[model samples]
Target: MDDGVRNTREWSPPPPASPSLVVRSPRQTVSRLRTRRTHRDWDPSLGRPSFAARDHGPKPSEVYGFVGSITTVIATAVYLAWAYTPEPCLRSLGITYVPSKYWALAVPSFVIVAVALSMVIYIGLNFLATPPPTSFSTMFDENSRERMAFSPAMEEERPIEPILDIGVVQINNLMFGDT
Candidate 1:
């Protein structure tokens, strides 16, 4: 009747976090000291809602994105107005301080060509760095490992085998063998 197993496991609080476990910068340390940090350090505390859990308007990232989107839209509108409108129309509007119209085509064209050339250069670098097919790297070099043999009876209890590369002969035999 006395088999040693409990119906429910006892709950234990997690071990205290060591200061040495985390490396913090002096600025971050000062910032942390300056702010009153609040965390739900217990399971039960999470069940109740708090100030941090409430919706606090738009996040900083969302605000930044909104501003960036508006700025981009305004810049594009200005660029289009500058590029398509005739010189006489711009001067009539008292906006004669705009850059040469040639830049509208040249800048975008240069950016496109730069991006394409960078991609080509990256591919060429990779091709140059790759080992030849006939190189010793194709076959596992002197660092190749053999899988340790285990008794058939010990298969269930055996530890996980170390990683070993399958040889070309073994691959061919597995694929093309009559057996």
Candidate 2:
């Protein structure tokens, strides 16, 4: 805290370039990156800028998420202002050239309807792909197996059948005395 230096822009004799950054070959360093950085970054000690200075901007990946979140917040604020602001008040605020208020309501309404419709479509697709309880495939398909005799080698081959639909009469008898 008491270095007497003002800030991060510590204007001192630049530190020696690390072995990794020192890419000198045949007199001049490979200056493919010199064009990217401004002349302000030129170090008198090194004679020219290196690729390290060109990397001052934020990484592409980091910018996407940060910008997306900020954009969403700004868009939401603008949408709310557009929806609730009174026309005369807006006009007084110098916002004269605007679309109809009906669009503000209609856009959100359409978006909500679209989201609801997508959910319905998802459910409909699931229903379309599934066989109903009463479908013939539910009772028996070509893959259905008949009950086989118990193997004497092992009485507990299986305690009960693996996959078979129960009879409606058996279900009714269990639930109703009249059955």
Candidate 3:
């Protein structure tokens, strides 16, 4: 006797005349919704001016000279006090001065002279090495205005180019003859 149940191998559902619903996966539905929302908000013509393009006025580096000068003066004063102060105070703190047999008197004097020389060198270097100060008006001059106007929208967005080591690269290429 044949069982009333249909064979397990064969199964089919009747097709609808019109598609009832396009069964999208949950991820696809969410992505499609986000895309639609983004497109709706986007305006092709009305691009916002970039930070570089905007006339934000004087750069911080222009005022850095004034601050640097003040700091350098203070630093020099502190260095002079530290270097030239008496060794007696240090000796009172139980720091013994074991002078060498050959140059007992000369060692301490030499150290003091060296320290003074170093301080002078440091101060001189700082004074001589500094960039010339830009005036407040010149800092915000026409050149800066032109720079701000012509600067690209994605100036900050560009990836930093790694500093090229041509010598190293050439040496490696010569040794390896291209892998």
Candidate 4:
């Protein structure tokens, strides 16, 4: 793979030569730029434009993202103004179409509380579903897949097997000096 990459890098095709147009004045510069031919625009082999050449504009997703960002900023400003502005001032300015600002705080607070409660419920469910430490499922569950074991004498010849689970006794002995 390395040799193939090195060979290709060393013998890659040279880029097409850029056209040189002598510009008489600043006025000609703009015209020359409009007519300028890049390697992408011209093909040296056929002396014409390449069939693959395309002037792709921004993708639909890119346009959507730009519009979405602008919309979000505008909406945020509107929400902040509606939520924070004094009721007396808004009435004085003849602005009565806006909904009550209570929703602005209530909606966000409700979302936060819902998310926190969901996490707590999920944790409780997991605890309820867990098997006890003394259960046989701890050593060999229905879902557990066993790896093939190799003899110690033939370990070097055989490929290394994935790690197998050890008992808590072994773990405690290794970490706590057999206490």
Model 4, which residues run further than 4 Å from truth?
1-51, 143-179
Instruction: At residue 158, give the lDDT of candidate 4.
Output: 85
Between candidates 2 and 3, which one is better according to lDDT? 2
For candidate 4, list the clashing residue pairs, or say none: none
Candidate 3 global TM-score: 0.21
Ranking by TM-score: 1, 4, 2, 3
Look at candidate 1 and give me any clashing residue pairs: none
Model 3: how far residue 15 lies from native, Å: 74
Residues 55-134 of candidate 1 have per-residue lDDT tens digits of: 57989999999999999999999999989999999999997788999999999999999999999999999989988998
| Cα lDDT, model 4, residue 103 | 93
Q: What is candidate 2's lDDT per residue for 55-124, written digit by digit as tens?
A: 5788888999999999999999988898889999999999998788899989989999999999999999
Give the TM-score of each candidate: 0.62, 0.44, 0.21, 0.55
Query: RMSD to the native, candidate 4?
Result: 12.1
Find the candidate with the highest lDDT and give its number: 1
Cα RMSD for candidates in order: 16.5, 16.8, 30.4, 12.1
What does candidate 4's lDDT look like per residue over 97-134, in tens digits?
A: 77877898998899999999999999999988999888
Error of 2 at 93 (Å): 2.9
